[model samples]
Target: MSAENELLLIMERISDLTATDAEIAQFNAWCDGFKAQEIQVENFDAVSERVLLQVHRRINKKPNVFLPLYMKLGAAVAVAVFIFSVWFFSSRVKSIEEIRYAADIAPGRTGATLTLGSGKKVNIGLATAGDLAMESGVKISKNASGDIIYTIMPDNKVTADAVNTLETSRGQQTQVQLPDGSRIFLNAASSLTYPASFANKKERRISLSGEGYFEIAKDKAHPFIVDTRGQELKVLGTHFNINAYSTEAVSKTTLLEGSIVVSTATSQQILTPGTELINNGSSLQVKQVDTELAIAWKNNLFLFDNEELGTIMRQVERWYDVEVIFVDGISKERFGGGVSRFDSVSKLLKSLQATGKVQFQIKGRKIYVTK
Candidate 1:
């Protein structure tokens, strides 16, 4: 039978007043497959109590009707979904305790800086939506949506090799459309440098100082290249993410859709879709990886799946633009979960604190971590 048929059978069993043990087991197995996304609850115990109360009300209203185990479980799930949907889809929840710090730290925004070839810095975040600059017969403009677009003139010619850089400071992220029509999303504390135009270039190449997710435009004749600190990724129209933070122990290149060749001084490997190549400054290792977790920053999410405390704090430090100081020393514990990047630092910290493995104190722009 098809999956839909199977699901219907399970639902029938759940709704039946006298479901057998085997039928109840099937219903529970079906319900277990359901998962709610983009929902954050502070007090799960309170939420569960409220949900159970609603389910009891539904049960009490139906006189002479018996609710089996599966029916009760299904009712509980429905009630919980209703409660969380109201909290998540609506405004941010105010139920969580408001943890106060010395200073309020807001979340990051879509912002970056454009460094012209002449060394002049233009704050893209503060600049209005209009023509920003012109270089090598290409017009650079920012749309109302804060996307930096580059329009290459029909008669575009590069007299000199002029390079422009776009950098996002801590607590900022931005998108840029390259002259080649490729789009890139730079994460916090990331930078991308490219030539004014690729008119006469044999290959489209750019340098990235930090993490950037790329959707390379297809060009059969000329390949695209990304140069990190000591690694290079060659692409022929693909979607990928590269995390080459200098502070990171190992640089990573994760392929999402297409193939990519990751090259270092010692080795080179072609990574297939769903493959990740880790460069440890000497050699390259390829392994199957979770593409969603690798490029979660571009989607405004902090997915820490079994990531170390120190690693998670590093990401928080960049997004909050704060300094992390260990009270005694860092813990070796790792965590697995996710939270919205749109949330305040306190909410994210509270989520971490709920694990009971660590504690945090914020003072001004500094975060003190304790175990």
Candidate 2:
């Protein structure tokens, strides 16, 4: 790795945490290099090269973009020195809490609302353990830890008509154990609708909106179906993630463990492990993608692989329940790295600001972006 790139990685990895043994050794080695005046911070992560085109025009991305935080500091005086001090000081410290602004926002939490077919809305965050309600031949309740669970009832009036919806708003997320035993992790501003029981159903089908990671239960006789937006996915049993947020410019369906067939109005394509099917309005496109990045939210991490700023902000807006306004219009810089999603919003923004091209101003619930 280039010395500059290594410094970029070292700076970010040190900010949020205590490093591992290998990381400590790496940090020590960098310190040795700096003693010999070898720490030239120019062109950090290739930031000296400018990216001024619209991000959408460059949808085809690099296969692997693991560069850490970036910043430009070429004799620009203040910006570089001040940011370098922060990065260097933070790196030396064992652990420093995230830098806080005059006003800061917290990360999204685990919570959602359950809407019965009868229109009854039960707030999962405010709910207690025990059975909330019974429908069709199933009982819905929360465990001792307040996790949602579905149990088959003795008189399971298993019918296709008993449907329920689990929805999450901004700043909240949720997971549900479907009647068929499939588990789905729903992201912020997303919802999943499924039947109460699948005892007599021909197929285990669910409707989704926004983004979700699905671990489908296998039943050769009953194929699992996930219908979202204008596309449909069919899989006997598999693990996959679907990003169909309406605000996003494209819909991504990535398979991790099994096979799935995604069907649109005009064409149908089958996706195997490590492949993604993208529906970008007019046509469906398939590509080899990093599956982990596709489901990073499900794993409590924000992984960006040369992703556009607009795309990154949409995720931030959904998770923190804030508005991202680009006063100078959207930036075209591509972000590449990974960070814990549970940290305070400023930490994330700081990482982004390290890119040196973009800056952020947080006012109340709004984040004003500038270049």
lDDT, candidate 1, 1-371, per-residue tens: 65444434443433322233344454344344333433333444454444334344433444223323323566456455544433341121121133334355789999999998878788999999999988878889999989999888777565437789999999999999987889999999999999877877789999999899999999978899999979888998999999999989999999999899888787889999999998888788899998999999999999988889999999998999999998879889999888899988887876887776876767789988877
| Tens-digit per-residue lDDT, 1-371, candidate 2 | 86555554655554433233345456656555544546555653343222201111122234214212223334343334334443354354333322224468999998899998788999998898789998776789987765678888765456557789999999999888877788899999999998888877788888999999999989999999999989999999999999999988889999999899999899999998999999997799999988989999999999899999999999999999999999899988899987899997888887887666676767799988877
Candidates' lDDT values, in order?
0.77, 0.77
lDDT of 2: 0.77
Each model's backbone clash number: 0, 3
lDDT of candidate 1 at residue 366, scale 0 to 100: 92
Give the 10-residue window scoring lowest on summed lDDT in candidate 1: 89-98
Q: Mark the 10 consecutive residues where model 2 has the least summed lDDT.
A: 48-57
- For model 1, the superposed segments whose C-alpha errors exceed 4 Å read 1-102, 155-160
TM-score against native, each model: 0.73, 0.73
